[model samples]
Target: MNRRCITGTLGPGLLVLSLASGAVVRAEPVFSPAATDSCVSAAYASSPGLSGHGVLDCIGRAAAACMMTPDGDTTVGMMVCLDGELGYWNARLTAAFAERLADAEAQDAELRTLGSAAASIEESLRAMQQAWLSFRDASCLYEQAQWMGGTGGGPATLACHLHETARQALKLEGWWAQ
Candidate 1:
């Protein structure tokens, strides 16, 4: 097998383009779910193409998976599938936080506590992450309720979750400078 990585700039910002098939597919930042071509991240166990796999790819797949459910397919089943993908992204976010925290601690000899005053950076990060989860849940609940009595409620809630989780994951990746 032959594998190669191609790196370039997309409109001045860094971009990683995947192998082609008549279209240019670029991986988006974490939490975005690349909105380009099909064949999302192979991590989703869905797309056969591993071209632009990333956090963004995972989320994109969640969106597609839910939206592409067959005509007779249940929305609840789609939501369940998306929830599993969200779980994977949450784990990635946690890993990013841990990696960044370790790097920060290693740079300062006196910073053995991982943070200064009040609480450890780890605790702070965990708290902030918890807050994000709470907010995502509450907001999605509202989205669903707003669409109650309509066919859009379930999808509205699922989309809210997928987008929020992906957005947070993107933030965590930014923190991981490495």
Candidate 2:
């Protein structure tokens, strides 16, 4: 067939066929393990160090998996980031509490009671973190309604809320530490 005849004959029908194929093309993976490892290592290397703990490894793996998922869904990515941050924080707090508990053995009975109280505080802090995450997601949805023109406000607002939530959670963590 001539070029124009072939092109004209195959145009709309071909488009319909392609649309009906029920196939979805996916983008490339957004996260790399080497990159994640380097980033996490540099991020936590100095302050509030991990000290060869397996929990840090778990957090890193979860983060990398979340980032690498092929869905390209920003909400899922945000949720993953929040989860990874909480996991890391929880692990760190638990490790710190364990260290303190180990050192408190030689103290008086009141000091032992204080150690138990500290454990309860840690549990409370974790629960508060979870509640803050729920609130953050809901508030972000409410705030982004004003800027819903696909101007990237939804993800930005969500990220901002996550930062604020993390800040508040960390503050609570500081209290728990004492």
Candidate 3:
């Protein structure tokens, strides 16, 4: 088996590759933020109650589609595609957090009426969200560090951000729903 990697500047921040079969493959611009958002939204809309796999499965669909495009195969293109998904997840996370926080506050108030001595749900949620932010930042930085200053670092970090944000969004949504 023979494998070869072709490197040439098609444009700024673009990378091209060639196969061992003398076939050349180029990346095109296929990443669309609207498309990504639509895919994510559809995933959520179609998901059966409490089933998260549907949304999770949609995470990299747009990025994979982008990578297959003629102008979107480069590292920078991948980062941009990942960022689009990250933006979607970040929005979801924000909405979910707000809803969850409100629910927690209500639940805490109910507990107070019952004269229960349990910890405040709203306060606990705030603390947990703060801790999760630190964890997500540290974990993503660690993922980038694994690339050791290589061009892959940027995409890896963005992917990490996407994953963490999506997970947090789902977690918050679940908490609110339950």
Candidate 4:
């Protein structure tokens, strides 16, 4: 894996997310039109009938691809390549998006279940978000600890984390649109 590519791509994403979450407490980062344009282009480029769900799927696939490591031989490499740490990220995001979409589409009798379902789904999403936040912070800390004396591993780790984070953010954006 090219460490520089990972660092460059991931740093901005982390910074953007931090700014969006108010975690930065200072200057807010602006998302360029290119970001939305790429998402829109990807959403409609292949399938015209694509809905918000389709966009979510695209985002998930993209996230999975970014999370994958080229080497899967060693333990750490295997974990990264398998994205074992990201399973919860994928599950929670998928469930949250699915429940929201379903609630939006529900009508009448089915609508009765909407409130309860949405509540449950919202709770799950919230918990998932919290867990993901913890994971992100811990991962960053671990990377820093490992690379405190050098710059070798920090960039790669940060890049991987950022890629997954951005992937999730893109999926969430699509869900919000719906």
Candidate 4 wrongly placed segments (more than 4 Å): 1-36, 47-119, 151-158, 173-178
Whose lDDT is higher: candidate 1's or candidate 2's? 1
Show where candidate 1 strays beyond 4 Å.
1-58, 69-74, 101-109, 112-119, 149-151, 175-178
Query: Which candidate leads in TM-score?
Result: 3
Q: Each candidate: RMSD to true structure?
A: 17.4, 10.6, 7.2, 13.9
- How many backbone clashes are present in model 2? 0
TM-score for each model: 0.51, 0.36, 0.72, 0.36
The superposed Cα distance between candidate 4 and the true structure at residue 57, in angstroms, equals 14
Model 3, 31-134: lDDT tens digits are 55565567667866776576656666666677767767765667777777787778878888999999989999999999999999999999999999999999
- For candidate 4, what's the RMSD? 13.9
Compose the digit string of candidate 1's lDDT tens values, residues 1-178: 5655565657632344545433354433222223322333334344234222353544546445544544213454445545555665667667877876776555443466556444455566668878988999999999999986677787678777867876676566662223
User: Model 1, residue 177: what's the lDDT?
Assistant: 28
Q: After best superposition, candidate 4 residue 121: deviation in angstroms?
A: 1.8
Which is better, 3 or 4, measured by lDDT?
A: 3
Report clash pairs, candidate 2.
none
Cα error of candidate 3 at position 110, Å: 2.1
Runs of candidate 2 exceeding 4 Å displacement: 1-29, 33-36, 48-119, 149-154, 157-178
Alpha carbon deviation, residue 6, candidate 3 (Å): 22
Model 2 is weakest, by summed lDDT over 10 consecutive residues, at 6-15
Q: Write the per-residue lDDT of candidate 2 for residues 1-178, one digit (tens) a residue.
A: 3222111124321211122324333332343344444544564554354333332333345344655565434554544444554545455555644554444443434556566544444454457657877887777776777676665564557445544544443343342243
State each model's CA lDDT, in order: 0.57, 0.47, 0.79, 0.47
